[model samples]
Target: MKKAKAADGKPFQGVQKLSVSLDFYGEKIDVGTLAWSKDERRAYFEYHPDFAEKRLNVSPFKLPVSEGAKAAPNSPFAGLHGMLNDSLPDGWGRLLLDRYLQKLGYDFRLLTPLDRLAYVGQVGMGALRYVPDNSLSKTDDAAIDLDWFAAQAEAVQGEVDEADVDRLLEIQGGSAGVRPKIMIGLNRKTGKFVADDGTDLPEGFDAWLVKFKSNVDPSEIGKEEYAYSLMAKAAGVDMPATKLIETKKGSYFAVQRFDRTESGSAHVQTVSGLLEADHRAPSIDYDTLLKVTRLLTRDERHVRQMFVRMVFNVLAHNRDDHAKNHAFLMAKDGVWHPTPAYDLTLSEGPGGEHNLAVDGEGKNPTKKHILKVAENASIPRAEAEQVFEQVQRAVDRWAEYAKEAGLSERRLQEIDRLLNKRGPTTAPDVDISPSP
Candidate 1:
C-alpha cells in the first residue's frame, strides 16, 4: 500500500500500481499498468509516455487513454462510463459498498480503492472491465417501483440502517458524486418508474435517473435542469435528451442513462472539478480546452462542434459552463468523441465571469475574440460563421423553447431579457441593456 496527501494535505492510502486487463467487447486488451498516487488522489497512466494521457483522481485503476472516436465506447472506463459517476449514488453507493463487504464477512472500512474497483465487476459502464471478480452474478433486471426505491434510498442516505436495503445499496457505491439518484424505468402502462434490479419492467417505461433534492438546489431544481436541457438542445448544443419525471411530490428532472439500455452498455468518462484538468480552478480557457479536445479526439469536425457550443454558451448566457461539464466518449473500437453537453444553467460564475475564458477574454468576449478562437482552433471561417448563425437563430427562439419547457411567462421574459442584451463588451463589464 502507498500513502500520500492531497493538495490540501489530506491523507489517503492506496495501492501504487496494479496490472489490469480490460475485456473490451469480446477481446482482451491490456490497459497496461496503473499507479495511484500516494494520496490516491490521482491515477497516472503510461500507454507509452509519448502517447499516454494521465487521468487524475478519476478511478482507483488508471485506464489508458486512446484517440479512436468509437473505440471502447462500452469499456467500464469509457466515455459513457463517466455519466455513471453521476448516475451511481455516491452516499447511497458508499453505504451499499460497506454493507456488501460486511455481508461477505470482509473488513468493509479496511478495503482499499483496488477492492472498490474489483466490486464493479463486469457490470460497470463503458467497455472497460477490471480483473478477477467473485464470479459474475445475474444482475437484477426487474422493474421495481421508483417511489419505493426513492423512499428506500432516501432512508438509507439519511440513516443507513434500513431493512431489506442491502442489495440496492451495494449497487450504489460503484459510482461517485453526492447526488442521491437511483436507476429506474418507467412503466408505459402505469406511468410509474421502476428500479432496474434484474427483472422485467412492466410495458412502456424505459431507463432514467430519478434525482432527489440536493444541498445546493431546490426540489424543482430537476425541473429547471430539464428546462435547461431543452433550451440547450434548441440552442444547437449537442445534448442527450431529457424529460421531467412527474412524481406525486413534484416533477423530477431525469436524464437518460447514456451507459445502458435493455440490451447492453456504452462507454463513459467522468470530467469533473475534482480532477480531469482540475475543473474547480478557473484558469483553463476555451482555447486550451479546444486544443486538448483536438489532441484527444484529433477530429477537426468534433473540435468545430465543440467551438460552436462554446460560442452558444457565451451568447446564450449559460455561464455554468465549466470544465467538468465537458466530456469525451469512447466506443468499443476505442474511438473517442465528445459526449453530449450537460450540467448547463444560467449562473453568474465566480465573480460573474466565465470559469473558462474565451480566447483569453472572459468578461466581455466580442465576436472578434470568438473568431480568433475559430481560426486558432483550425475551424474554417465559413464553417464557424455558419455554426454561429445557427446558434444565434436558435437562441433567438429561446421564448419558444422556454414555453415548451413549461417556464412561466415571467421566467421566459427574464431569460429573454438577458439573452437579447449586448454580450460581454469588455473584459469585466457585462452589458445588460435591453436590445434594440
Candidate 2:
C-alpha cells in the first residue's frame, strides 16, 4: 500500500500490489502477484512459479498460467483483469462501498481497482483472497435483524444519509447483483440466522445470502423468485436451495451460498470473468456459452446442463441471462464444473430482450433459434428437444408454482401472459441435421 498527499494534505492510501491465494477447505495455494502501473494506467499479474507448475488454470482463457507478467486488457473490466475484477463488488455492493467511503471522507473517484481489491481482502466471494488486507470491517457475529437491515437498505437505496453505514457495509458482505443483500449463517433446523462475515460459522449454521427488494422490485418479488426457483428445479435445472424469509415488514429471498462449503470455500469464476466478457451488454451468445462449457469442463454432461439452463431461461421468461449470472466451480484438483443456476427471475433485460441472444436472435427467439444453438454446440437434436420440452412443461405449470409461492392472482396472471406471449413452445419440423 502507498500513501499520497491529497489536495488538503491528507494522506490517501492506495494498494500498489497484492498477493493472491486460493483457499480450498483451509488449504491455501498461492496464485500470483498483482501490481499496478501508475505510468501505464493498468495492472499486471504474474503467476507464482509453483502455481504455474501445477497447471491448475485458474482462469483458462484470459489469465492462463504463464511465466511472465501480463498487462490486463483495457476494455472489458476497467484496468483490472477479469479474475480480480470478479473479487470486487458491483451494483449493490459497489453502491454500499461508495456510500461508506464517502461517509469516511474518501474520494470515491480517486480509488483505483487495486484499492477496491484490497478492501475486498479476504471477504470476497469464491476462494480467492487478497493481501495486505485493508478491509474496512471485521467479522461481526451479531444477531441477525432482517427487518432492521431491510429498512437500512431502503434508506441506502433512497440516497438517505445513513449514520450506520459501517454496519450496513459489514452486513452487505461484498455481494454482487442489483438488489441489496446480506451474508448470513442460517440454522435450518431452528430458522435462526447469524451474521456471516465470510469467516467460520457457528456449529449447525450454513452460509446463505438473503436478498432485500430494490426500489424497482415488486412487493412480492421474493415470492416470485422463490416460485421461479421451484419451476427451474422442476425443469431439471440445478439450483441451490432457496427460501423465502417472511418478516413482519416483508418477505425476503434467501439462497445457500454455493461458493462456501461445509469444509471450505469453492473457487467460482463467472463466465464474464473467465472470458473477460462484459456482462452489462450482449457480449456473447448461448452458442459461445455452451462451447465454453464444453471446452472448460470437457464434459458432455456439463454441456447438456448448460443447454437445460438456457432453455429454462428462455421458457421461464428470464431475460436477465447475463454472463455474470452463469458461473463454474473449480475443485481442489483444478477440475471445473458448472455451478448451480442463480439469479433466475423475470427480467426485461436491456430493452426487453435477452442479455444473451439465441442464434443471434434476442427478442422473440423461437424453437428454431434455440435448436440452432444446440446444433452448433453439438448437442443431439433429440436431447435438445427433450430438454426444451421438459423446461416448457415446467413453465406451463406456472399457476401451480405461483399459488404455492402465495403470489397474488394479478401478478400471477400478468406473468402468465408474458410467458405465453413468447409464442409456441412446440419444436418445428425443420431439419436439424448437420450441414456438409
The local distance difference test score of each candidate is 0.57, 0.85
Q: Which stretches of candidate 2 lie over 4 Å from their true place?
A: 1-9, 139-141, 421-436
lDDT of 1 by residue, 227-285 (tens): 77776787678887677776565566677666554544545564441123444447578
Which 10 residues in a row give candidate 1 its minimum summed lDDT? 427-436
Cα deviation at 306, candidate 2, in Å, is 0.5
lDDT of 2: 0.85
TM per candidate: 0.67, 0.94
Clashes of 1: 54
| Candidate 2: tens digits of C-alpha lDDT, residues 1-436 | 3544545668877889999998876779899999998877789999998997666888999998879999998778778899888888898889888887777667787788898888888888998999988776664456778998889989998888854677777767668888888999999999998998876789999999999888877778889999999999999999999998988888888999999987798889999999999998889989999999999999999999999999998887788899999999998788999999999988767777888999999988889999999999988899999999999999999989999998898778778766764334453321111100
Output the lDDT of residue 58, model 1. 24
